[model samples]
Target: MTSTGTLSRAQGTALCVGAVLGTGVISMPALAADVAGPASLLAWLALIVLSAPLAGTFAALGARYPDGGGVSTYVRLAFGARAAAAVGWCFFFAVPLGAPAAAAFAGGYVADILGGGHTTMVGTFLVILGLVVTMNWFGLRISGRAQLWLTGTLAALLVVTVVAALPHARPANLTPFAPYGWAGVGAAAAVLVWGFAGWEAVSSLSGEYRDPRRDVPRATAAAVLVVGVLYLAVAAASVLVLGPALGDSPAPLADLLAAGVGGPVRVVTAVVAVLLTIGAVNAYLAGASRLGAALARDGALPARPVRTPRRSLMVVTAGSLVSVTLPISLHTSMLLVTGCFTLVYVLGTAAALKLLPPGWARRGAALAFVATLGLLVLNGRPALLSLVVAAAAVAYASRSTSPKIRIPSSSSAGSIAPKPNTNPVESLP
Candidate 1:
């Protein structure tokens, strides 16, 4: 049986926007300033350009397949089961590793609101995770109306910050543009991509769209461009207002706004920041659950009670355990997951190139895939590690005797192939 309900174009776009413009927007500026300073703007620009076609490729793939498993399904259709499984495994690892960190981030923000130390912060983290898991478990839709309100409010907050800080702009902060060299810019770019990774998550729900082929790609591209511009604007504003000081502060925008505007604006900004983080959590929880369900349906995971209230809770429990056990810091875990996602996109774009028929468009997609692979690998160690693991997964899958689970080729009813009849060996008469 197939499920019916899907998102409208606007909802799809909002989901994509929400996924990309998560807590990273608030946190990444500081990291960028530290690693690349003014040069980080260039890195942002590079990513903007690189991510466009990369995202577009995903949008196109989703439009074509319009199924639940976003990147995994795309890769599977273009390559084969082994390649698909590798992508799925990488994505699965990336999300679990990153979830705890995200919970930690939410905890920190909650602490900011309630005034607490590490113990309170951890409690807040678990509470927030549990609440979000419950919300998803209960079938909260994050409807178009909700997305509009959250996205609009977040955009307004950012605009307010940028406008308030414009008077403080100092071009001097941009000097020594590559203060830490181009390498730092590359590192920042890799990290920044993490902030933008979820744009494709929106496309995974293409099967639910009213007219996925027409709507999904358009919404995906629009969301990417809008978010890219927002990031650039915010990054530039951070440099202008906070300069080198931005590097040390976690909530640089809020701090800059608090210092510049003061009074009620500070409280308001704080509230919006919390909301933005919540939106991120919402998007992540929803996307991850759907991806898990898709994988389960494909027999990639042990078939469990998917499409149930319990699934999100299960993921949250697993996320909590991972958060406690992992040695890597929250920020570093985000970067590592971002790196894993980049590798996923590299394969995704390659799949797009292969699946799309030969043409100028196909050639362009192939070029973009190559470029994305290069950028992803530029992270060196993490990128190399992810690649090695993917290779191992592919090798294992190729040798395994697992059932070949295939999606029916035709969309019409009665398309499913019938099983052949087999008779047991007869006993001697």
Candidate 2:
């Protein structure tokens, strides 16, 4: 097959930006504010600073080793197949389970605007899910142009929201800064991780860049700058303009808009929320489908009569639908998903430590590794979900490679020492 690099530097930057932007932007500021008051801005800053090295490390790896296998490939190269499979499974399952939670974020906005409460939210979820599944079914339904437009729309909306809201800012909002105390800032930072969750995804696109060695770094730098400035701007404006009420605003951005421009902005905010949700879920499902196919091809997953991206996508979408029906709270589901992605970040950065050439890049990877490790710890008991998923992947790989035996068969040459299966899945899963 002839391969041509189709993504320009601008395109790559947009992709990275979108990856890191996430659905959290709609609500994170308020959630963090609730946890830390105006001091949550510090958490926003901490996350932004952390993103520099984290994004750069992945960009460096992507430039050096451009492959479809992405972080999983890097992991396989650094630590062998089992670890790679574990990483793959973490991503594959993370998506669908996370999907309902992601979609519901938008649903809340819709319900706020349309007034059907839970019914409205659930209806919105179904519509978004249906759109995403359709978009992914024939292969990635969103064109690059569509994604570019999506990013543009979001960037524009955020800018307008912040700029409009800034004039309303009051110094009194910052008077006591840490009303919840310094411990609250830490709590806020923990909540903010969702906003910064997708930088590691930059690796998957490295192979698509026109000149990855040169462009990956540039794109990543651009993305980090944009993401940092935009996110901080929104968060700061939320605190400064909305003051004490910021924490209680379900649609914080809309509230900012109303406070700034006054009247009837919920509809616009709801539309933005829907667009953001679609883009996020689309990206997750698209990437996971491809990952599933790759995993099956490599033998980490069970072989199907037909192993294709569509098949993988369906399985993932199905899981997402089932997750929506489950009795779990959206908050708990998100935590579960966050745990999986966090573990992926941990493993990806650890892999980068082995794969990158020495000096700044390797050092950056170390920094990312430590940050992500701390995040995993912050996840507390929810993080145990990642461990379980990883273990399942390893077990599946083991089953594929070696047959179970009765007693301790002295035949080490057989199942006991069998060669390992090397492929794994979505892990958007």
Q: Please tell me which predicted candidate would have the highest lDDT against the true structure.
A: 2
Q: 1-429, model 2: which lDDT tens digit per residue?
A: 112456677777776776678687888888899989999999899889999998888787777766555676667668867887898889888878988888788899999978998888889989988887775554321434456678888999999989988999999998689998998988787677777877765565566566767888898999899889999999999999999998898889889888888888899999998988777776676567666655665566775721566677778877887888889987678778888988999999999897776899899899999999998887778889999999998888776762321221221111111211112222222
CA lDDT, candidate 1, residue 88 = 69
TM-score for candidate 2, residues paired by index: 0.89
Candidate no. 1 TM-score: 0.86
Best by TM-score: 2
Q: Pairs clashing in candidate 1? A: none
The Cα error of candidate 2 at residue 67, in Å, is 2.4
Which residues of candidate 1, in runs, are more than 4 Å off?
1-3, 112-114, 140-145, 264-266, 305-313, 358-364, 388-429
Where is model 2 poorest over a 10-residue stretch in terms of lDDT? 413-422
Cα lDDT tens digits for candidate 1, 177-251? 788988898888877777777755665566656677677878887788778878888888888778888888766
What is the Cα-based lDDT of residue 258 in candidate 2? 89
Q: Please, what is the TM-score per model?
A: 0.86, 0.89
Query: What's the residue-level lDDT of 128 in candidate 2?
Result: 88
Whole-model lDDT, candidate 2?
Answer: 0.76
- C-alpha lDDT values of all predictions: 0.67, 0.76
